[model samples]
Structures are given as C-alpha cells and as structure tokens.
Target: MATPQPRRWIPYPPLISVCASLWWLSAAAASVHEFPTDGTVIELDDASFERAISAFDLILVDFYAPWCGHCKRLAPELDKAAQVLAQLNDPITIAKINADKYTKHAAKYEIDGYPTMKLFMHGVPMEYTGPRNAELLVRFLKKFVAPDISFLESDSAVQNFIDMAGANFPVFIGFGLNESVILELAHEYKKKAWFSVAKDFSEEIMVAYDFDKVPALVSLHPKYNEQSVFYGPFEGEFLEDFIRQNQLPLTVPINSETLKLVKDDERKIVLTIVEDELDENSLKLVRILRSAATANRDLIFGYVGVKQWGEFVDAFDISKRSKLPKLLVWDGKEEYHIVVGSEYLDDNDQGSQISRFLEEYREGKTIKREMDGPSLIGFINSLISIRTVYLIVFIVAVLMVIQNFSQTEENPQFRGIQDGAEGTDASTSHIESCRDYQPVNKED
Candidate 1:
C-alpha cells in the first residue's frame, strides 16, 4: 500500500487573502447578535397610510380616543402588539386617531368603539376589530403574515415569525403574563426557549386559547400558523418538563445568573463565548478568574461560558453579551470593570483599576463583561487563598514592629523626657510648675 502523503501547503497569494479572510472571519465570529424586533411605526391619517400598507404583510390599524377608559386599556395592549410586531419585523402600521384629534380618520373607519383593530391585507381591510388580547391578535394576524418557516435559516434568525408554531410547532414564545420567577428559570435555560419579555399584555392571545397568566409559552406549527399557540409561563421544572415532553433538545444558553451565582461573592466576573462545548474556551475564562481572585481577595470573581443566554452569548435583539465575570467597580445594567485576558488581569499595577471598580460598585454600577485568553483559567483553584487571615496577621505584625522600634529607639537620658513629652501630667516637664500663677488683666 502507498503511504499517504502530507497535504500540499496553501498557495502564497491565496494564503495572504486567506489570512485576511481569516482575520475577517475571526472578527465576524465574535458573535454579533441581531434583534428580533425590527420595523417602523407611524401615526398618520388613513389617506397617507394607505399608500405604504401594500408592502407590509399585516397593516394593523388602531382606532381610539384620548379620554376613553376602554381605549386606555387597549392602549397598553396595542403598544405591546406593536412591540411584538417590531420584534417580528412584521411591521404593523398603527394609526391612532384620537377620534377627537383625527375625526376624519376615525370617521372613515366608521369606528364605534374607542379601540378597534383592523387587520388589512393588500391595503384592503380583510379582518377588523379589536378589544382583543395581544396573543389573539398576534395569532389572528399570523394567517396574513407569512410564517417565514425556512429552518435552513440559522436558529439565530428570529427577527420575525409567522408559523403555526408556539404550541403546535417547534418553538416556544413566552409572554409577560408569566411570573418573573418562571422567567428566571426560563432564563436559566433561556437558550432552550424563545421568550417574549413584556411588561404589559393583552388577552387577545389568551382569549384565543381561553387561558390566562403570562410569561405564557405558545408552541407553533408551520401550517396552522393562525391558531397555533400553547399557553404558559413555564418556570424551572415545569418548563423543563415541557421541553422534555416535546422531546426538544436541551439548548444550554449561557446561564448569566447561575454562572454569576457559582462564583464566590468576593470574585470578579469573567465572560466567554465559543462555537461549541470545547473545554479550551471554558478553561480560558476559568483561569482568568482564578488569577484575579488570587491576587485580590476583595473581588467578586466569576466566569461565564456563553452557549446561549447565559450572559456571554450574543443576544439577537440587543446583539451583545449582557453579563460576565470581572471585578465591578460599579453596578451597570450590562457592564462592569472588565479584564479581557491574562495580559489585563495579571497586571501588577491594577491598583487604580481595581479601586475605581470598587468605588463604582459603591455607586451601584453594574457591568456585563466578555473576556478571552489562555491565562484566564490557569489559577482558579487558589482563589483568594486565606487572604482575610493573612491581612489580619500582616496588620498585627506591623503594629508590633512599630511598638518594638519605638522602645529600642528610646535613650536612657531621654527616657524621662520621652515619657513626660506625651505624658498626661504636664507638671512633670521642667518647663512648667504645678502651682498656678496669677496674671493681671486691665479689664478686671
């Protein structure tokens, strides 16, 4: 049998381009996220709005008044819908006529209620009426909106969705009606589920399913896009069960909170993101934390490996890592005093940087850090080794040294003087007498 030959080297000119391309690839591989919400909103008269409605998949019109109670309730719902639409990239054209402000627009739609939704297809009204919940409206609008269900697209592609999915399909969308705790658990495995975080909500989707409460999860189906949705606010175990029930593969998103939790409160935060479950990346971050914690006992050190939503993974909407392990001089919403690698972490002169971060934390600054490098995981096991104990011993030793030095420095002749110099009895000094002396004052 012929021995296998080594592969030929890459050509020169091509290699140069390849190097450049590699550089570009490395830059791109840094994981820049794209948000799901994308689109423009407008508040205009019907005449001006009708022109652009044709291009949009769904043109949702809201008829309302500034003073109506029903309208006020509908306001939050519609705003939520707009936000969801924005996230979906479906781009809803919301024309709010304060029946009193745009009587012409309101009158043209023949609006009876203070709040109403008209779903238009091709610039012509196909389905109309509101007083509906957000999910229902979202569900109802799906028929008209293309479900964009081409799985060939990266799972990262979530700008907009129109599918029977939710409960019926392969995906899950969580709503605000769900509890924060549930969301927190969902967050734990957030990469596993697609969540829609909302502060307010509408019953459109709920009434459609006759279920209430949020942080709801709606499963989706590609064909039944219009009516597909499972209700939820699935928390830790329950959410986990649902995933298992569906036989969904577990997606390990970077558990920002959990990773931060694993750290000793005194450690700094370290963040990392990689293409796979490679230990090289994991060890890189762990080592950095190990070193920093070793150097300074005051740091609240931690390391996060971003698989998804665990803090370092690129978020589709915000397109950034939210939390990482690094000493926090301050508490930022998504930031901290960062240390990128051993180069930055192992600096002998971290005095200014460390102090600044502490001061920042005092002022309640928060930080989300993303860091990389080899030296990161090197010394994690020796973190903050007996630092408190050592500090106490060092202080006591310095005090003792000072006391002994003062005793030895004293001269026999000057001993009395030294005692009298700082002594409580001033009379012992030669300069002063124990008896008081009277002094004459002209005023007396």
Candidate 2:
C-alpha cells in the first residue's frame, strides 16, 4: 500500500565518479578504519564495460533518460537509496548507465520499462526488482548485496509463510509481528475466524519473522477475517484462551467446565496425556497439533499430572476426580473413545498423528500413530540450540584432554621401556672393580 513520492531535485556530481573502479580499492581500505562514509557512483559506458561490472558482487543498474519526467523524479530516489545501502555496507555498485547513449546494451536487455531497478547477478537478470523509491530500491537490492537475509521480501514471501507455519485460510501476515504459533492456532476456533495477519518491518521484515528469539507463526482461520495471532510468547491461560476460541479439532484442555461437559453433557472429550515435566518436545508437538487442527473441529484437550498439576489447573482450571493417563474419546453416556497411554497407534503415523487426530475428529474415525522418531527429532532439534550443543562439545573436549593426560602419566618413555627394560640405573651396578682400582693406583 506504499507509493513512491516525487524525489527532490538532487545534483549528479555526487553520483557520477569518473574512474570508480580505481577509487573503490582506496575507499574499501579507508572504510575499514572508519565507517562506510559515502557511496561511489560509476557512470558506465562501452569503453571499460566488462571490467566495471566485475568490481562489485551486486550491481543496481538504473537505465534512465534525462528528458523523461519519471526518470527525473527517480534520480533523487536513487541517490537516497545509494546512501541507505552504503549504511548497510552493501557492495552493490550503483551505476547510472546512460540508456540513451548506450542504446545497443539497453536493447540487448529488452528494455520494456522506464527507470527499471533490475538486480543483475553477473549480468543475468534475477528478482529483487521494484519501482524507483529509495527505500523499496534498497530492499530490492539487499538480497543480493547483504550477506544476512534480514530484509522483508514484501508480500511475495506470503506463500512460503503459509507453508512454513502449516497455515490455511485467513492468514495473518504479521500486521505487527503477532506470530506465536500456539496462540494464533488457539484463536482460530472462536467465532467464524477470518482475515490473515502479517508484520510491517519498515525494512528488516524477514529477520523479525525468522524462528528467532522473537515468537513467530503464520496462521490461517476457516473464515476469511476471523484469523488470530500472538505477537509475543504466551503462557498458561493466554495461550489456552486463544486456542479454545479457535475451535481446534484437537482435544479441549481438561478443566472444571470440561469436567462438567463429560459429566452432564452429550458431547465427547479428548485429552493429551502430559507428563509430569512438560519438555520442549511435548510443547512443540502441541503447537504443531494446534496448526493441523485448523482443518478440524469438535475434539477437546485434556491434561493429567500430579507434578505440574498447579500449572495445568491454572492453565485450564480442571478438577482431579478421575486421574488416568488416557486419551478418552468420551461419548455422551459413558467413556467410549479410549486410547490408553500404554497402547499406541502404529508406524503409519510416525510424524502425522496430530493430523490423524484432526481427521478422526472431523470424519468420525479413530486415528492413532506412534510418534517416536518425530518426538525424538523434535527433542534433538530443541536441544540443538546455540549453547546446549556447544556445551556437549565442550564436555567432550575436556574428557578427551583428561584421557590423554592420564595415558601420559602411566607411561614415561625415558628409553622406550617404562618399568622392566635395561635402564641407566641398572648399568650403574656393574661398574664396581674398574672405578675402585683407578682410585687405589692414584693414591699409591
């Protein structure tokens, strides 16, 4: 929804350096001592053509005619863009190639548009294209120039976002970074969920959205505008409330109201058997479940644990009338849907039991799968954080050092044989008569 404004009239001297390739080496050397001061502009011509393009990793080619109104409007924008990109230390050489003078090269490129900001990687055209505004131009050029992919890919990344988060209808494209997968998954059940959400990272959109320290998720709801989100990490009731509203096809959390439904109502209930200590693997599984449940409705969740009981009760407010680690598909009159903790559905659903649960919830069939590998995979992935894996490596290095030191202390190879060999100490015992005779002759 952003539009390019008319660029202010800026002069071209700052943008038109005579021998830019020669100046760049000096500039790069100085930039290390100081900061990136200013951007160098090279005017490209047919004379030293091939050599100029090779000077930089990325090149922002501006093919413009001085007479055109749009070209004039875009000039100042390009200047501002050069300054911003300089701050990022992007190695894109900004060349204002005179398309008018170099008609052959322009025609070779199939010049269909005016003021086209095409990002060429080694002379071949690629995406990272946009209109003439400096901000947008900087964003377009960043992917090729900057090493880290911190900038947003505009609305183009939406499809991938859906795939990444396992989202469906009414996707939220981070209106203000509301991406926490669990809360968004939870909120989709409330009402007729519609509308998607997304973030507006004035510039650095992708970094802000990566599965980084900032909580992130791409969610979809059944209804177009009824989608929901949790921008930051959530815990206890905030998460439960969001999930409950979404009408997730998974188990409804066990609590006082849920207990009443099992006792006095006609509907069924399904509860996940949470262990005493809810580890990250279990937590990730819950989030993934929340995502898959978007396609289903009717099933409820339950939790049973004496150790983290307070957390469970506070999260969902359940009573401890019947405490069994079971996934009870409670049909109205009596407990009907019972998948015992000891028994598990087999191999076919190694990683997709949550999906199976949703399918069963909607289609009135039971689906259970043993989630061992995926569970362990998730556990490994969780533990493979920056610090934890490094800690393991550190411990291994220390143990190896200790083992080497222990071997060295047990064997001091002074002549190769440590204990039973003929050493210098053993030879000293045989030199008795020769030494005594020499001392006696001298005295005599």
Candidate 3:
C-alpha cells in the first residue's frame, strides 16, 4: 500500500479573499460593533474609544505610539493576554489605541508615555502600575472581570465533581441553592477558586460533612483531607468572605495540578521545603504560616517535600548540604528569597520570625533573585502557540461558507438567509444571558 500524502492547500479567489480579509479586519476593529467581534485585542481609534470604554464594565486600554520600540514589544503580549481573556467569555475587554496617530485622543487620556496603560472601571480611568507581561496582565484584568462559576445539580454529579477537583483544586460547593446569585459568585472569584452549586441537596455528602441547613457553603480539599462548612446567610458580601477564607489550603503539596492554584492571581508563593510528610516542627510552622496566609490572602502557602519532590527541592537551588526543612518566598516574577537559617524559623517565638519575614519583605529587605526561566514568558508562548494557524483556518472556512451562500441572481431564492443573518447579528448583541449555563438535568 502507498503512504497517504498530505492534502494540498488551495488559495481563495481574489474577490472572496479580499472580502474575507476586509470583513475580518472590520470585525477586528476596536470600534464598538453591533455584532460580536472575534480575536484577542480590539483595535480602537478616536471614533471608537469612548463607546468601547463605556460599553464594558471593565476595559484595559493600551495607549501606544507606533514608532516606539517598547510599544512594539508590548503589542504581542497584549494580544496574547486578550486571547486568554476572550476565552473565558470574560466581560473585561482589552483594546489598543494608536497614540502617535491619534494625538488628540492620546492627549485627552493624558497618555504621555509610548506605551501607557489605563484600566477603566465603570468608565473611570486609572493608571495601571502592574507588570507589563501576559500572565500579570491576565491576572490584573481578571481582578476586574466577574468570577466564572459552575453549577452542578444532581447528587452524583456533585459528588463526582467534588471528588475529581478535590485532589487538585479546593472545591467550594454551595448546597440546596438554585439562585442566580451563586452563578454571579462563580464569576467573581472564578480566577482564585473553583465554585459549584448543587441545587438538590445530597443526603450522603451533607451528613458526611455534617451540614444542618439549606443554602450552606462547604469547602473540601481532598488532598489534605480537610473540609470546612459554612452555615449561611449566603448573601453576596458574606459568601465572598466565606470563599476567601476557604479558597486555598494552609499548606499544599506543590505539584503540576496544584502549581496553578499556588501561582493564581499573581500572588507570591511561600513554600516550605520539607522531607516528605511534615514533622512536628514543620507542622507547627505550617500552622503559623496558615495564620499568616489567612491574614495575607495575597500570599499562597505551599510545601515541597524532598522525598516526593526532589526535583522541586533542586529547582529552589537547595543542596544536600543544606538543612532538611527550609522556607522560601517566590513572587513568580524573578524575586525569590529563602529563610536565611533553619534556626531563624525555629529560633524565635512560635510565629514571630515568619511575621517579621513578611514585614521585612514588605519593607523591601528580602534579597531578590532569579529562576531558571520566567513563567510569564512560558505562558505567553503557550498562548501564541500553533493555535494561530487553526484560527486562520477557521476564519477562512467561515468566510468561504458565507461566500458560497452569497445572494447572487442565481441564488435569489436564498435572499431571506442573508437577511436572517443580519437580524441574528443585531439581536445577538443584546442577548447577554449565560449561554454556557445548562438545565440541571442536562448534566446527568
């Protein structure tokens, strides 16, 4: 038998190619459109900037000069960040305005820099002081975007979801609820934690967790065998507090699955390096670290045991000559610091040293260092991966389909099809309900 050959690529006709390119270019334009636009970044000009700002609850606008090298460098990162945000169906919009070309508009926004960034919340603009990278940008934008929440309706589905995510993510399950508020919550903290709503109460899991009331919140971390149950009053503010309290464990094993949780929302990681199972002293430090972490939700607490995570220990540059247990803080950027001596952790009163360590860190006393590679670049690379080819193919296929069904004199009978497409586009702009949501029975 002969080996199969790859399919040959064919070019579109000149007319159709030009039409598709123009259509896509218009769709990619920054100006607000009646129809939903595809792609990562929206290119805004003076005409579209104001409407685009007011249209979204939160919008991140990049004011960039065409000739500036810095602006050119940031463009790709901004594009990648927009792609990530678009995937989540997040309300946050990433848009760019050509400051050099639109001097009047740039002056209006007071963009004095080549690549200045401003975040608009409810149409009010504020300067963005965060890092200029994809991960940080994504993390920063998500802060403004509403949380993405998941709703699970049945007993088996709820249990299975909990069991599945329990090992990786800390599962926050709200029981005996069918309100839109929970869905709203899922979007609010969607970046920080995983949330689920179980409309029908599960008798077995409820008894297992020992919850007495309806509309209660339960957090279960199957990895550590820890469960926290909250009796409601599940109001928005109250539930937000409940979620922050139980979103993460005090000390979790740092692995591929949990690495994301440890690094989510651009928080600094306070990792305690141990042998395998934590000993008495390590456990005491974990308790103190948990207390510190509870107060400082900005920090993620985790542990890397040597026996299980030998590579992790070496990744931190810890040698065999070093002590068995150690503590370190990594900001995922490039700043990494270690607790000077094991005695520093064990010498002081129960929590005093760690407190001072955090204080010193805030005081800018911690020694800055670098990792083998930056995670942000790794993430940006992932975002700008081979998906671009697929995206172009998809766009081309869509354009060809539309062109094939064009309403020429030969296809006069299909005139309604073109009109219906236009009507759908007009109506789609207004239909803002949760399209991802499904009926409870649909899950089963």
Winner by lDDT:
3
User: Across residues 1-444, which tens digit of lDDT does each residue of candidate 2 receive?
Assistant: 899899899767655574575588687665342322367555667654444555455667777666657778988887788776766755565667777677776676755445555566776664333446677566545534422112234455554544432322223344444434434443433222222344443334444344333344434442222344455445666654544444332433444334443344333444555544267645554555455444334444444444554443222222365442333354433224433332232324423665555445555455343322332442353223333466788999999999988988877784367444766666665465456654446557
* Tens-place lDDT digits, model 3, residues 1-444: 999999998866998889999998786464456414454587888887878886666778898877778789999998887767767665567888887787777878766556778988879997775557887677556545533555677778887766545353467777876646567777766645567777875578689877887777788777667777778767866777667656667666676446655565356787777766456766666777777876786677777777765655565666677665566788755567864442245545847777777777676666656664433443443233233446778999999888876736467657668667669765675464456555797557
Model 1: what TM-score? 0.26
Q: What would the TM-score be for candidate 2 when compared with the true structure?
A: 0.29
Error of 2 at 181 (Å): 16
Model 3: C-alpha RMSD to truth? 28.9
Alpha-carbon lDDT of model 1: 0.45
Q: What are the models' TM-scores?
A: 0.26, 0.29, 0.41
Off by over 4 Å in 2: 1-37, 146-444
User: Candidate 1: lDDT of 209?
Assistant: 39
lDDT of each: 0.45, 0.49, 0.69
Return the candidate ranking by TM-score, descending.
3, 2, 1
- Report the C-alpha lDDT of model 1 over 58-101, residue by residue, as the tens digit: 56766666766777877766666666666654555444545557
lDDT of 1 at 337: 44
